[model samples]
Target chain A: EAGVAQSPRYKIIEKRQSVAFWCNPISGHATLYWYQQILGQGPKLLIQFQNNGVVDDSQLPKDRFSAERLKGVDSTLKIQPAKLEDSAVYLCASSPSDWSEQYFGPGTRLTVT
Target chain B: AQTVTQSQPEMSVQEAETVTLSCTYDTSESNYYLFWYKQPPSRQMILVIRQEAYKQQNATENRFSVNFQKAAKSFSLKISDSQLGDTAMYFCAFVSNNNDMRFGAGTRLTVKP
Candidate 1:
């Protein structure tokens, strides 16, 4: 049973630039999630997917942030014209179902200069 | 809307000692779930323990345990025989039947040897 996987463990980009992060959830997990954690803060839910369908994404900034899980397997989160406030860690997690314990990825730390 | 609160921003416990981290939540749903997650410097969020609202008995895993008070809407984590590996950022989370999860700001715990 492999854990969730994420790419680009560390990224640095100038403010107003675009960036994207990828996530590969654990096999057989039906629920996938994306969260953003700023320094000294807990992870904040950005989006959630249940079998390729968006379950929740109210906190996501629609003007700049977008995510997709088309095949119900891997997913990607993108930020267009990133801002300095976007410098944080992006975490991916997966769970078998609702209310189940989630397995998390190592996360990608993004730094906006 | 659900909210989780961690009153303690930072705490320190000597190795082999015991320490407790306080958490409180506000939710209108009668049935829900609570979780405690540990995020080390490696940037991976690990599930420490979980508790169901309906369950009367507290949840425990190895040296970690939780004291859940439903009436007061409080949930506290207790680490017994604390070890150096327990040092990390601890976050309290909540989720209800709607499957919308919320997290607290987190508490930084340092286990000194």
Candidate 2:
């Protein structure tokens, strides 16, 4: 089976600019996730989706960051007015269900100047 | 809230030798899942091993194994006969029944020839 896929392996933007990242989950997987991993830090959960509906996004920065999983297969994460501290790797993962092990994608490394 | 901690920021081992990475987590929930992921220079997050909190025996995969201590809230990774290909950033993560996954600051491992 194909693993999770992400686009624009690297991205650079100025502070206050806007940026977006895309992800395509594995086929037949019902759960999708977005995580932000800062340099030297582990990946932190940003949002989670079960099909086209959100399961949890309590840790997401709703003020500036938003994500959507349309039709329950592909998803996108956007950050507006980016901050220098936002320079990190954004990872996408998918699982068959809430109880299965997650499969991750090659992350998009975003750098905000 | 759940938090994972990797006290070792970095480690090194000679090829064909063995090394261990330490991790500890804090959580109020009784049931959860713990994971160890590896991120090489390619920046792909690969699941190395996973352990369910209720399980007493450690989980092993080929050259990689985990020491899961439930009462101590600790999980450690032991790499046997380490190879240069093992050089990468290792992260410890946690996921609860609610399906919220949390990660720790990673440990960069270097294998010397």
Candidate 3:
């Protein structure tokens, strides 16, 4: 079975600019997640979706960051009016269910100037 | 709230040697899960191993093993016969019944030839 997939391995943007990252989950996976890993730090959960509905996004910065999963398979995370502190790697992961092991994809590295 | 901590910021070992990375976590939930993930320079967050809180036996996969101490709220990863391919940032993570996951600051491990 194929693992989770993400696009645009790298991106660069200036403060106040906008950028987006995409993810395609593993086949038959019911749960998808997005995480942000800043330089010198570990990845932190940004959002989670169970099927096409949001399960947890308590840590998401709703003011500038938003994400959506449609058809329960594909998802997108967008950051508008980016800040230099937003420079980090965005990782996408999927699990068969909320209680299953998670498989991750190569992340998209975002550089905000 | 749950928190994961990796006290070692960096560690090094010669090829074919062994090294261990330390991790500690705080959670009020009695039943939870712990994970060790490896992120190479490629930036793929790969699952190295996982352990369920209720399980008494430690988790091991191939050359990677974990020492899970529930009483102390500690989990340590041991890499045997380390290889250059093992050089990467290793993160310890935690998740409970609520499905909220927490991650540590990560430990950078470099295996020298």
Candidate 4:
């Protein structure tokens, strides 16, 4: 039973640079999610997808943050023109269904200088 | 909108001792789920335990247990015989009937040997 996979584990970029993170969810999972965790804070949901269709993305910064789950297996989150406040850990999680417990991946930590 | 709160920012315990982390949530939904996730320095979100709102038995997972108070909207995690591996950031999360998940600001725990 492989868990959710994400890459790269860490990243560094200057302010206003563009960065992207990738995620591969567990097999047979139907729900995928993206979350952002700032220093000393718990994760906040950025977007959610259910088999290539978006379920929610109210917290996502539409101006610079965008995500896509093509084919419902793998997903990517991108942040263009990164800001210092965007330095955080981006986590990807998957669940068997819309209401099941989630399995998370090792997050991608982005440090914006 | 649902909100979760972890009033404690940090806590320490002697090895083999017990420690408790407090959490409270605000929501109007009757049926939902609660979860406790552990994030070590590695930044992986590991689910420690979970509880369903309809179940009043609370949730116990080995040395980890939860005290869920529906009336008071409180969910607390208790770790007995805490080990060095228990040192991590603990987050309390909530998911409403619509599957909207929200998390608290996490509590950092350190176990001293």
Residues A16-88 of candidate 4: C-alpha lDDT, one tens digit per residue: 9999999999999999999999998889899999999999999999999999999999999999989999999
Clashes of 1: 0
Q: Over the stretch B42-95, how does candidate 4's per-residue lDDT look in tens digits? A: 999999999999999989999999999999999999999999999999999999
Fraction of the native A-B contacts that model 3 recovers = 0.70
Candidate 1 residue lDDT tens string, A10-77: 99999999999999999999999999999988889999999999999999999999999988999999
- Candidate 2 regions exceeding 4 Å error are none
Task: Report the alpha-carbon TM-score of model 2 versus the true structure.
Answer: 0.95
Which residue runs of candidate 1 sit more than 4 Å off their true CA positions?
Answer: none
Error of 4 at A104 (Å): 0.8
- Give every prediction's interface RMSD: 1.0, 1.2, 1.1, 0.9
**Per-residue lDDT over A1-113 for candidate 3, one digit per residue giving the tens place of the 0 to 100 score:** 78788998999889999999999999999999999988998888899999999999998999999999989999999999899999999999998878656899999999998
Worst 10 residues of 2 chain A by lDDT: A95-104
Q: Which ten residues in a row have the lowest lDDT in candidate 3 chain A?
A: A94-103
User: lDDT tens digits, residues B1-113, model 3?
Assistant: 78899999999999999999999999889999999999888888889999999999999999999999999999999999999999999999998878667889999999999
- Weakest 10 consecutive residues, lDDT, candidate 2 chain B? B95-104
Task: Enumerate clash totals for all models, in the order shown.
Answer: 0, 0, 0, 0
In terms of lDDT, model 4 sits at 0.94
Model 4 clash pairs are: none
